[model samples]
Target: MRDAVGRRTFLKRSAMGSAASLTPTGLLAVGAGQAQKPAAPSERVRVGLIGVGVRGRDHHLRFLGANPRVEIAAICDVDRSRADFAGQLALRGSKRRPLIFGDFRSLLDRKDIDAVVIATPDHWHSIIAIQAMEAGKDVYCEKPLTLFIAEGRRMVNVARQYGTVIQVGSQQRSDWHFRRAVALVRRQRIGRLKRIVTHLGNPGTTSGAFINPGVWEPVQTPPEGLDFNMWLGPAPYHEYSPNRCHFEFRYNLDHSGGRITDWGAHHNDIAQWALDMDASGPVRIEGKGGFNKAGPYDYANYLEVHYTYGNGIELVCENEHGNGVRFEGSDGWINVTRLRLDASSPEILTEPVSGQDIRAYDEKNKSEEIPGTDEHHNNWLDCIKSRQRCAADIETGHRSATVCHLGNIAMRLGRKLEWDPDKEQFVGDAGANILKDKPFRAPWRL
Candidate 1:
């Protein structure tokens, strides 16, 4: 009852909820985890981490390793150095040695593991998540859930088909201020929502970005401990370059959608949730991009995308806004980001929720305590035991990722596109449709 839109308020009025058989019981299932029967503390959730890179080790390992009700069974990465490094940290921190794996499948093959956390590159998310779900392991996958729109659909379908308990790594959904921001917007604290703006930073300037005027990165041999071929699974093989791996991989079209899918996946996702369009998407989109003119840098150097939602709401994504989401309505506006939350009329943010007010608007929050702004990992663990959905469930993630993909498609094709969100296709453009999915490089099939 303490956070944002209390459960009943959320399911009934925001983000939509439940259906026939396949749909989630609730979109975020906000407090649904605690409402169900509790799992004994001794019943630990055995987690296997699939990528030991920055986020995998820094966040996932840090959080999961601390939870008393979870055990990190293994750590896997294409890069042995990363895997071993994180594994050592895990051992020292948790006082338990976890198996280290070069290939993700080795971790997935272990029947002892109950869930997998995928922090691999954008291209590897779909295949690894799909297999994890099919193997009956719940998943906590990082943002930009899929490399392509088609892959997002496949993830959603496979999640439903397998009854997978998945949590997308759009961690902001579980942050306290964001939860309150979304709740206030849904409650009309800002009046009828008119427009939303997100200031996602420039995509073309990632530290080691290869195409920035004066950089010469030539093909190099794969690093000693890395299995480059396995790392390239599903993506077309390209000669190794320092720019082609780690953080820099995002700037490449073959592996990512630049900031469009990277940062857009986060801010755009929050925008979708604020608009209560988690199950649906925009009807029209167009982009104006300062694409690199004389180089192979496929991503736009400066990008701005405009989307018109079915409810006649407009969302603009660009770099000028300074890295946060601002929701503007008829009366006032509310702004939020990981670091801060402020509003045009501060009174709306300062207003306190009374005990009487809680019962009048929402009751599910009265029934249970939703997992608060922790790492958002506990919500997944709780949902796994409760058999409920998470704060960032698969469908919600797919829809958010779709918003990113749509913007990327518009920018790439340099056209105004009409989309049928329900049908999951471009209205009439064959070229746009063709880009929905890319053929996975051989041997790896969804």
Candidate 2:
């Protein structure tokens, strides 16, 4: 039970008992959900990959390619060079080379594809996922889930309607430390929760710094072999600029919500999970930050937002509190980051919750041992086969992303706004409500 919550915990809870339908007597069971179990071991799952950029190649492609039960069926990217490169990688040491696709729609049309892995820019997340689901394919979409709050709602609805297994790329949910911390909080190990302070690092990249200003001018022409127009997708068409594409896209408001949505998506997700608010959000939020007023990057460089949950729990989202999340309660507090887990009292880390006390989330399915991106992908795959919800289900992702979106809306508005989580709208604030959704360019509407 070392990495119990890792994969062992999942299996332990899933295998606790079997329903009558799966039992020796073979009695009909009520509400025994159905899942598309793999027909055979040799029947490999055909997967199509869209967006072979940094995360797509390093995480999705690499991990999916390593899964013996999966076949890298097709690779698609707006950039021809990237697509070709991914195709070659998928075809490496294999007799059947994966087909290369410049357009994701072409990849989605193939009946051979059972699922799709999307690592596209944030703005394109919802559209591609919705289309893929509509086309009868499960989706493994990258984090921040959507560009706007409304899009997450649409994704949740579509996922349920199609019964598609949609797993948002919030890999932290699968981490041992996070899972343990969530268990502790749920068991009241931290006592009555008082506040949560999350450090999202920065808006630009994982390096925790923004791109230097005045380093490069926007390019007049799109780079060769890159379909910049198609890359923009539903986002408003902006002139192709090297600084405005790829990793830098997170800094652009048109493409991303700066650090608010970038890192906030990850840390805020943990905060929501600990607070048991995966399906709801804060009632009031507001903050202020310094934005790149006159630079190629438009996201806030230094920002802080405060949220007031209905239960009076205060959550602070900032870029300067250092990396990770800190949860404070009346008795003690615990702080968790990717690298370390610290607590006010050392015993908090030592004390293990009993089975009855551990109530963070229900478990299901005994999956294979895989860690990091591989583990998260495997979790989604296991859940897909078992018809179980993913660790980071679409609703969980939507709520987490909504928290980030709310912070961004509050930051841009520079005023406290009352939020109606039940209705998913701002209370009597036309301007704030207007920011809930962004308009798509011609022929693109979610």
Candidate 3:
């Protein structure tokens, strides 16, 4: 299970003098994950845009369009209107007319494209990114990385095999505040790390449902201008529902793990980053919550999960815990979110970071804008040029997503489960093991 890079779980003593344990799952094995250098393109890197919905149009297109060195080579979406809108937006500031396609494969077929921006729903992230990388294109994929834990593992293997540059869209890793917080934790400024509290918002309701009705809604015909089957790629086929497609899809378990993976992908990721657990995850998870038993939305609603890491650190994921990561050590604690950072003592944030202090992944020229001017996206573009690792690399994304998946599994199963992080499997639960991967609809396989 050792990867292309020589990364392995290392035993580190907590301030309390306890050593962390890791499973032999081979996930810690890290090696050179970079793809062999592609033939260098000209000054501007050519990119293919996939899933031109809200995030695709707003964040990716706007940022790539703003960058002088990036050309939107192609745009693809199941929805024709969204694709056309993104194509027109991508055409701005570039001499080359961007190609518009209804399918992502057509965009991947173009040798002119060097990389891809994947803003599709959670279910589509793994497949499209893997296909794009296999086609010799680097990828910038949105967060959570996969629809299931197995998909995330497969994604890591494929990326390593292709030597492609893949960055997960967890922008907090590139934030100055997050970096500083991680550095301080590594420096033991907060004494020894003990526990982390993460706040992810509540699971949302399903489309066109009032409560848990326990009855399947009648399937509806596909909407005009949208390819319903294509949109459900790799997922179990069901009658089309407007709520199952767009932004509301996150609340549906068929496509996503709801807020557990949605916002958990963000906040729990920070907990992993600060605790140096990006390459590993929890050894025990126990959760309980309310499910949408009466509504069309089946994802968990009110959920709370407690995770215990190999090193005896506890991570609590809950609703209303406040939206951020709070690291509690022996001396004090520091909490950080998108809004701002608050610490038990001001000195934690004020202390000067030393050269030897643990630092977050770095951009060669921090001052120069990367592709999106948004630090996380920019890191990926810069890595494409330098063949370096992005802030939220594939491994990091997989590990973090696993935490969320494990929480969902624990809650859904209504049990306290023992996990072997190294083995990446349940200790003894046969039923839990069955959930690592899911059955996709016919004609779609990973």
Across residues 1-446, which tens digit of lDDT does each residue of candidate 3 receive? 11232111110111123212211111111112222233222545688889888888998898777665567889999999889888877777666789999999899999878899999999888889888988988899998887788889889889777666778988777765566677677778899999998877532311121223134556688768899889988888877877678877887888988878988888889899878888899999999878877778888777889999989999998865446777899999988766566789998877666433355522232233222246666567656654556778899999999999999999999999999988889999999999888877777666
Q: After superposition, how far is residue 402 of candidate 1 from its true place, in Å?
A: 0.6
- State the C-alpha lDDT per candidate: 0.78, 0.78, 0.76
Between candidates 1 and 3, name the one with more favorable TM-score. Answer: 1
Model 2 lowest lDDT segment of ten: 23-32
Backbone clashes in model 2, listed as residue pairs = 4-9
Candidate 2 C-alpha error for residue 399, in Å? 0.8
Steric overlap count per candidate: 0, 1, 20
Q: What value of lDDT does candidate 2 attain over all alpha carbons?
A: 0.78
lDDT of 1 by residue, 186-250 (tens): 77888999999877863323122223322447889998998888988999999888777887777
* lDDT, residue 228, model 3: 83
Worst ten-residue run, lDDT, model 3? 6-15
TM-score of each: 0.86, 0.87, 0.85
Off by over 4 Å in 2: 1-42, 202-214, 354-373
lDDT of 3 at 89: 77
